[model samples]
Target: MTDILDAAVERAGLPVHWSWRIEVRPRRRTLGLDVLPDGSIVIAVPRQTTPEDVTGVLRERRLWLAKAVRRREALAAEHPAKELVNGEGFTYLGRHYRLLLVDEQTAPVRLRGGWLRLRGDAGAADIVDWYRVRGRHWLIEKVRSWAGRVGVEPPEVLVRDLSTRWGLRTKDRSLAFHWASMQLSPDLLDLVVVHELIHLLVPRHDDEFRQRLLVALPEAVVLESKLHDEGRRVWMGAVRAAL
Candidate 1:
């Protein structure tokens, strides 16, 4: 596999300025390639496909591969630095809250007196850490409220900074949400949280699922559309934060 990758790189004559790696997956039925967030490539091929064939396919897709790799690298470069100091903002329930740095003797983030408060001078990573902790707390409370109203309760709930997708549901009734949803409005955020939790009972998106969701959220379609258009910006902003 290493020899095949080396040969492909040699044949393609790609630039060496950027870092790259390749993974060979024999389970693949055809030549396939994927670009990782760190600008590396993972190439897969069926057991029957020859190295020469893999190289040719990669060569044909070189331009696309290069563009994908560059985009991933660019997003990584845009990730934001964290701080509770002035000029930093936090996204809570789909709204942007400018971090109003205040002089406090504690080292914790709080939403007090109608402001998202981070009570220490911390870097971007710290701010994210605060969110990972406090954010889940907020999410759990909100999800419980919505679940009660919807008459559905997931067996478990999880929250994290997911790189893709708003939320997911597991077969065992575990519901997960992308922490970035905090950037959205409370109503929209609740809608998403409830939607994922309901999937614990109804695992697939079918008519019954839509019906239940509508009963749970009368404005589900409207909010879903808004998410499709504007909600993507939140993820994009998070990617830019990588810079």
Candidate 2:
């Protein structure tokens, strides 16, 4: 079913040696483990799978998963949590701006006096809306620019809140980007743009795909390493206090 059946699984006396939580999915052909960006693991299993099989798989991969989990935890600790309050640092286009709340402002969000100004007592919604709007606009422009360089038609940008991916390219040639991409510096963000645009030419990440990417962005490898480092700071565990 979904992640909700975890209690039943535990009650059934399955092994819980795995440090992270698991989601058992029946009616699926594959038994897979996804390490989410929020530092959680989702284990998907087929209907015919046994608790013994799942436990075996987990045990076999225990060391690798443990290392992965530690990395995720370190990243989370690096970014921590961001609270929307006066003088709190918020990023926009590689620069940090203090969030200044003003009561008399008409707009819910905007840039005023170099601060990410909010009208009144704002929560997650207002901040998310503002980031989404900016991310969408910026990514659309990047898609257009990078597509032309890649010799492909520009794809329509779809901004989304994604936990498992930074960017995705669909069969329809449209590009989907995580909204937090806006927090990245322009150079780092360009790497994501170039990556998705190249996917338009080569769907799979095979040799030819990498060759083409290098041709367009010669420093792809270095840029990728930097992106991973900077991205950790951009990815706070959760925005809302409740989350």
Candidate 2 per-residue lDDT, tens place, 1-243, comes to: 333345434543433553456555666886787776556777777777766666667667667777777787676687766766678778877888998878887768897678989777666577767778878998888888888888998888988777657899866878898877788889888999999889887889999999999999999999999988888778433663433
- Clashes in each model (backbone N, CA, C under 3 Å)? 19, 0
**What local lDDT score does residue 50 receive in model 1, on the 0 to 100 scale?**
66
1-243, model 1: which lDDT tens digit per residue?
A: 677667866787667775556566777777778887767777766667666786788778889988998898776555443434555666666666666666683775666665767555544555556666766788888878877877775346686766777788755677777766666787788778878867866878999899999988889999888877656555333322322
Scored by TM-score, the top model is 2
What candidate 2 gets wrong by more than 4 Å, as runs, is 1-75, 240-243
Badly placed stretches (over 4 Å) of model 1 are 1-62, 73-85, 100-105, 108-121, 235-243
Estimate every model's Cα lDDT from 0 to 1.
0.70, 0.76
User: TM-scores for all candidates?
Assistant: 0.61, 0.68
lDDT (Cα, 0-100) at 178 in candidate 2: 81
In Å, residue 20's CA in model 2 sits off its true spot by 17
